[model samples]
Target: MAEIRLAIVGLGKIAHDQHLPAVAATPGISVAAVASRNATLDGVPCFLTIEALLASGVEVDAVALCTPPMGRHRLAAAALRAGKHVLLEKPPGASVAEIAPLEALARDRGLTLFATWHSRFAPAVEPARALLAEAEIRSVRVNWKEDVRHWHPGQEWIWQPGGLGVFDPGINALSIVTRILPRPLFVTEAVLEFPGNRATPIAASLRLGDAAGLEVAVEFDWRQTGPQSWDIHVDTADGALVLSGGGRHLSRDGAILHDAPEREYTEIYHRFVALIGAGASEVDLAPLVHVADAFMLGERRVVAEFHW
Candidate 1:
């Protein structure tokens, strides 16, 4: 097998918990180096900044960026300009418009640029899409709520501008929704609840629709205390479809359809390998477009301040 030497940019929780392990388990790819401002991996060459790593002439063929969405464009563009394939974590960039130029850059350089939506790689997500594609969909409701304190403890960047706040997790639901449903979706109405002390929304209520007038009601909140809830319910003319456990579990009218362990990151890595080998780029911004639309059409309400 042809090997791809990959460097990791950013050593945060997601990189350690998901990207590292996935790359280790995947074939044809291995971690050659890492760049992080605060953390380092044992036995691996680490640099303070991406530019430093690229300048050091490290033998890296690909780069996975796990940093916060803000400032990622520069890092990714740097990697591509240095002749390396790039994989971006969810929400691709801080904004929808920024991703296209990166795509064009990769195309001009003949490098792979993958804007990955990991939730779409969930075990049941494709099955739901296959099922929904054949059924007559009637309605959709997305309840994506989670405790930000437990998930993002001490992550001060989450409240900053361009951090996406609650939509950080909520966009996962939108990714699956956009993939499974047959029709294109657009936001109709949105009510965003911003914390009195933060620059982003803590909770949001959104109404989305397609050309045929199919309505999708969405609720995103970062205030749940107990078990995190990541569920999507779709009411169709055939039967109701439920994708829960962040796309890990799926049921049709209460009968289990697809349930399995989550291998989303591993699958993402495999896709990355294939794309790099084929010299192709997979950059889909539909989910991020929905997020941008919500911000554009939503009404803002200042809620109580959040602590921790």
Candidate 2:
């Protein structure tokens, strides 16, 4: 197929900061149209909604759904029914169940569906997987903390129901964990701290374990103040493997290993292109499942009301 004419739905910060740049850098794929409620881009047909964009007679072959997870399934289903391939942003849907029907729809239509976990494309991720494949896994630790003001700012949907709040970023860590590990991990227990004023938790701690007794400790906090921390440290029989700077840096036993420039979204689009070429779909719900499990098994505590 020729360069895929892609439409990006939702003009949030992530759309401009990540998807726009990634699509520009990747070959064999270019953004041809956009659907956003409150934003516009130069040289592209912009619509107020995805439905309007789809009906606008724009020559779009695929769409990247970057909207908040709450109602994305409707858009994905519409795109699939319209015979267009779809690329879903992280944490594909509001709930784990919303993805299966869309997956079936894509399969029925023979169109590609990608539930993207962009963090899995981090420079160190594949290499980390490769290394952990041969080593005896011991334990995993994740400390993903970032200030909402710095990252999300006034994004109110994030604090609303199904926005995933802290898990919005925490799911990225779960993505990397599910990718690198050799086996399935389940949430054993969790403690969630929800602000009295918000509908979601601002901080969370979770304990996870595999069938083989390997343990993983997770800490996700949107209330972090200083230099943000996005790190995962794993202890093996040989020592420890660390992925810091949000999987941009990798170190083994205090030795620098893979520290490549981060182009995670670029890699995502590259994989999306390949999937479309092959007429295949990539929808892995392991990360979202962990988040779901965390919520299901967590202890909720009401805290002070969060402002801004």
Model 2 vs. true fold: TM: 0.99
Model 2 lDDT at residue 50: 89
| Candidate 1 lDDT tens digits, 1-308 | 47999999999999999999999999999999999999999887899999999999789999999999999999999999999999999989999889988999999999999999999999999999989887888899999999999999989899999999999999999999999999899999999999999999999999999999999999999999888889999998878889999999999989999999999999999999999989999998999999999999999999999998
- Candidate-wise lDDT, in order: 0.95, 0.94
Superposed on all Cα atoms, the candidates' RMSDs to the truth, in angstroms, are: 0.8, 0.8
- Model 1 residue runs over 4 Å out of place are none
Query: Candidate 2: which stretches are off by over 4 Å?
Result: none
Ten contiguous residues with the weakest lDDT in model 2: 131-140
